[model samples]
Target: MFAARFHPPMASAPPLCRRGVPSDRPAAKDPDAPNPL
Candidate 1:
């Protein structure tokens, strides 16, 4: 049961990381412009 609980969540993690939509922070298009975060 303990292994079952941990394994499923870890398996799903890779897809989330690949999506690259981390947090609400915005990506910068230009270095001179202010950070959108």
Candidate 2:
């Protein structure tokens, strides 16, 4: 349930998320990360 919201952003940047970008870590949890897309 909690992951639904985060899914969108993560889906948008799966590469970054998969790469485990430390900076993008927060972005995976929230949409506050600098959207490179």
Candidate 3:
């Protein structure tokens, strides 16, 4: 399952990195979540 662990963070990192805001925390938690961006 080690690869699975990396996958989640890798997938989440893109949106958070692009947004570069604390709001990304929630957005990353919920992919369907809407963002002002």
Candidate 4:
């Protein structure tokens, strides 16, 4: 669960942050929803 909590920000922090400017909250939220391995 830590990975789920941390990985997305670690992986998508830049893109997420970039999109966050335009309110792309879902983009970040989407990753957390997936149990991608």
**In TM-score terms, which candidate is top?**
3
TM-score of 3: 0.48
Please identify model 2 stretches exceeding 4 Å from their true place: 15-37
Candidate with maximal lDDT = 3
The digit string of per-residue lDDT tens for model 3 on 1-37 reads: 9999999999999997778775777668677555433
TM-score ranking, best first: 3, 1, 4, 2
Identify the runs in model 1 with alpha carbons over 4 angstroms from their true place: 21-37
Q: What is the lDDT of residue 3 in candidate 1?
A: 98
Q: What is the alpha-carbon lDDT of model 4 when measured against the actual structure?
A: 0.73
The TM-score values for the models, in the order shown, are 0.47, 0.28, 0.48, 0.29
Count clashes in each candidate, considering only residues at least 3 apart in sequence or on different chains: 0, 0, 0, 0
List, residue by residue over 4-29, the lDDT tens digit for candidate 4. 98987788788877776766667656
**lDDT tens per residue, model 1, 1-37:** 9999999999899977766664323443443256453
> What would the per-residue lDDT of candidate 2 be over residues 1-37, giving only the tens digit for each residue?
8799888877879776666786667667566454543
Q: What is the C-alpha RMSD of each candidate to the true structure, in Å?
A: 5.1, 12.8, 10.1, 14.4
Clashes of 4: 0
Against the reference, the lDDT scores of all candidates come to 0.65, 0.71, 0.78, 0.73
Q: Best to worst by lDDT, what's the order?
A: 3, 4, 2, 1
